[model samples]
Target chain A: MKTIQAVSYPVHFQDKAYKELSSLITKNGYSTIFILVDENTFEHCYPKFIPNLDSEKRIEVIEIESGEINKNIETCIGVWNAITELGGDRKSLLITLGGGVITDLGGFVASCFKRGIDFVNIPTTLLSMVDASVGGKTGVDLGVLKNQIGLFSNPEMVIVDVDFLTTVTEREIKSGMAEIIKYGVTYDIKLFKEIKKNKGLHINDLIFRSIEIKNEVVLQDPKEKNLRKILNFGHTIGHAIESFYLESEDKKNLTHGEAIAIGMVCESYISNKLLNFPETKLNEIKEVVLSIYDRINLLKEDFAGIMELLKHDKKNVNGQVNFVLLNDYENHKLDCKVTEDLIVDSMEFYNF
Target chain B: MKTIQAVSYPVHFQDKAYKELSSLITKNGYSTIFILVDENTFEHCYPKFIPNLDSEKRIEVIEIESGEINKNIETCIGVWNAITELGGDRKSLLITLGGGVITDLGGFVASCFKRGIDFVNIPTTLLSMVDASVGGKTGVDLGVLKNQIGLFSNPEMVIVDVDFLTTVTEREIKSGMAEIIKYGVTYDIKLFKEIKKNKGLHINDLIFRSIEIKNEVVLQDPKEKNLRKILNFGHTIGHAIESFYLESEDKKNLTHGEAIAIGMVCESYISNKLLNFPETKLNEIKEVVLSIYDRINLLKEDFAGIMELLKHDKKNVNGQVNFVLLNDYENHKLDCKVTEDLIVDSMEFYNF
Candidate 1:
């Protein structure tokens, strides 16, 4: 297990991670240590994480409810009040020990607590490890909108221990694979091939490679001014879909990965039409993505709601909905705009 | 009027300030310019501010109600939702025009909106001009606790136009004088002499000198790690007093400057007792502070609530309540802890 060097911090893998975390704890000499977790992580991950002996500082655990719906300012208020009541101060250290929801919310809590305190990310779920935790993007969804409130605040270190992944279900792993597939399509065809060939077999190798690709993209443009827009490849339409399902009373909420998986297929169809994306490659991407993810039947009526939400996407600048389109594997075009009709056609293609 | 160079941005005065702002707006070519204001600023400051012909970018006004009590996460969610609803994107520039409340709340709002947007602080009130808008510290209160939730985020530029002070109340002007008085006590005795000699007549000189002293300290320590804590000399107890009065229903909330005036008096007494501070100097300091401000009668019953609130002060690092104490004018100590009995005695002295 090698340490992946980030912009300012290090990302340590399995065995070395605990040692690094312990050393950081002793070195920083924080007034107190507060670990942020959800119910799921508290039940499964915290037990395993606590045994790795660290320091003498008093450690307090703050837990929020599990789920994406809880990832909002209301939840943040609860956690902020909890930290204040728990005697957490400017010198305190917050360790996020769950999936993306915990890390995203916890990272934001630490960043804004007393005008920024130190924090570490110990991403337990596959989605968090590969996508959410590594990048300095810590935020919560606004209403039904995804990641509408947040900032780019890096953690002390990211400890990626595969041991936590044992508790994650197969569905969660596949959800994470959507991002891995994104990396393959946008940055590296090798990654796309690896996931397509082995499915989710080499979990460790896939996670490491996906993180490296994300790190490279983030390092070039941490603030997402230009180069970083490509990472929003599936996110534009995916987030709208995610928000739509979550907001709809009748529809079952789709996981972040599930929504993105459908988005990748729809976007690929759009790319095939506009960018001369090879039809053969589009079918290959669609088949492989659908093989791993259940083909969601997006109703015609749902299109209006999702389209309305798309107008509020964070990536939009100057009233234009921007999408990251690809010509082929590993070749992404930034700031590409498609018409509503083309978008509808792509959604229809996904349903078919 | 000279432009005071900050760590990254410039603090432009009256005439030059508007020019700098107009140029910034033109150069950045922001997608939309959102002006955040309170009801007071919307009524008084916005009309004067808008005539200073700026860019053709779409300008949107986001009005929050005036008062420190409204500075909380709830207000932030409303502003964030409004920004989303009003077509505010990443390329949006937020111009906070009002007192400390607007700048502090608006700065935090802009920083967290779309993971940070460009923001300019136009401090309309005396309190904001000298202290809040200049410093990179932006935040909202949590349950009567002042600045309990926030982060250190600098604005693009700060426009200190004293012409807007015509709209400010005498009491509000006196409130801002607290921080100016704090500058004299902590950083420069010359500032103390000027204020005492002129008695608020020389407003322009006072604001500039206060900003200079504050900028110097902030430059040395932007994050309030070491030397910057000196700025908190009167703040530790001052904020507790402010929070105490704000929370008490029967009592009228003391303005920020008024609470700090009481705090300076109380803290000076503590310095005289613990730090072997000169007795005559402490009396002189007390007289100068009391001359411009009305002394509030604090009851013995109020001591417990004030003391309890002191424990939750943002300046505290460890479990101990930290105070920034001064030996004499321009000579201060950081991270100094005093007995709870002594704190109670200081309150008694303020009453006396």
Candidate 2:
């Protein structure tokens, strides 16, 4: 029920968020209100979201297909054309009610529509609530390159309604848990210990804490110049792996969290080898991550492809692929470079 | 050539621009430097542009086709892909070298690439040097709607070299004169009087004064909320006519300045009827505009389409077509509404 203040906007929780959203709509007097949703949100959340907003304004729903594959410029063009066709204009407000793909893509659509329009994020999935909610990073992937095209543009507000979580699948919940686990490894030892307890995770408490931790880091470095790189601890390898799986003939798609869970395990091994990361902590991290996420079998032929994908990582400076490694729980080393052979060795370690 | 200090960056003129650019390249340590140009700039300006930049950084030229018709999302996707394929990254520098279309499109491309990269505008054509060089308005048009999608994002600096003017056609120079003329009508009577003198016009003084007037207006109203609306004095009707000619089956493709010349004539009539603008001054404006530009005959059938296009103007607040009109030289009124019949009469007046 608490509202967390971001750099420019506020993140509200529970039923109170709807009240805030209603007031915001009245205050702004937007010409049109557009809610951007994927198939999932349109089915479940849309039914709930409409009744809550107390406004007589013309509300229109713009829907895209549900998946990471659809998060590209083609879909953006569709939404833009749709908004224009639907009589949406400069004073229109876009409300994104779905997962990361919806929020990220929707936020970007608003940012470019008529130079920029007001938008609010009502994140339905846990991945979006804690991860996408705080960061103003709005963009879609260029090909399989994760978030290759996007800019940091803040939303009017972020509303996190827990009721939407009940509609999500168990796998979807675990996908979000990856980012929370990331917060544990890179920022908070207590969060890591809580997950390590092996009991049912306190979803609400975890989501609130993860948002707080992520917001703190973003406040200091919104553009991801230095300190923010720590949030990318597992992402360098995770994104490459995600892209590799998506493009492979097998088409073994991985949820973002699932890929990142693997990335954390592999990066932990590299951290132990290069940094003075204790052997025990490395083993503990791998065990904890593996326990939460099913181990993915990476094809021996896949290593070269994943490495190739790493070259296109957004974090890379000049020609070198940079990684965020941890020396211990909550102790991060930024911009560390490793050889392709070492990365291969880490994957081999994961297979073992 | 004294550099004009804009809101954030300096506007360097002539030979001194190259010196400032070389020093900037040395200072930023950009990973790569990419220059965006249309075919015209690539052929005429690129040869001269490359020799001036004194850096060993990897320089690449990405060329789009010439003209306003190509200023759409398709061209942007191509440039975005080209930048990605050419190994452009976050630290890359994009130097847009051409007229308004090239700078506007290139600036938008850089602003969205990896969230944003540093870009410099090197306006080669007279139109760009005075108009596009100062305003950070970057975007591509959607369909026939002019500037339907874009954001206000600044470039690192703008290099205005008058030497490139020699490469431009008389018509192209005249297209730029429209914006300078708009500035004259909305902001400074001296500029209007100077253009009225008809002594073949002074290029350097006009360019400098145009930039100063535009920069001063932009500093106060960067987002075009109030005072900045004056800049759109003729754009509301000018853009509709421009789009009308482009989409017409005959494809008359009136040069931007020519279409705007008609717009100023029509809108000035509206100003005279509604705002009590002196009819004699309006006739003087018409004469001055007609002297430099040839009139495009608009079919009676075309008037309805141009009117329909007015509804899509970006300046519309709540379905009301907003126009910026002048009561007198340097005395402007914002958000003026005119009836359809009066608009028709105004066009008839132009025909007369």
Candidate with the greatest DockQ versus the true structure? 1
Which candidate leads in TM-score?
2
The sequence of per-residue lDDT tens digits that candidate 2 reaches over residues B1-352 is 7999999999999889899999999998999999998888899999988889899999998999998889988898899999999998898999998888899998998998889999999988877887888878998888887887888899999998888999988888888888888888889988888888864777899999999999999999998889988888777788888888888887768887888888898999999999999999999988888788876666788789999998898888778999888788889898898898988888888886
Q: DockQ each candidate and list the results.
A: 0.85, 0.79
Candidate 2 deviant stretches above 4 angstroms: none
Across residues B223-265, which tens digit of lDDT does each residue of candidate 1 receive? 8788998888777788898888888899988898888888888
Model 1 CAPRI quality: high
Second chain TM-score per prediction?
A: 0.98, 0.98
lDDT string for model 2 (A32-72, tens) is 99999988889999999889988999999999999999999
True-contact fraction per candidate equals 0.95, 0.73
Off by over 4 Å in 1: none
CA lDDT of B262 in candidate 2?
86
lDDT (Cα, 0-100) at A296 in candidate 2: 81
Report the TM-score of candidate 1, chain A only.
0.98
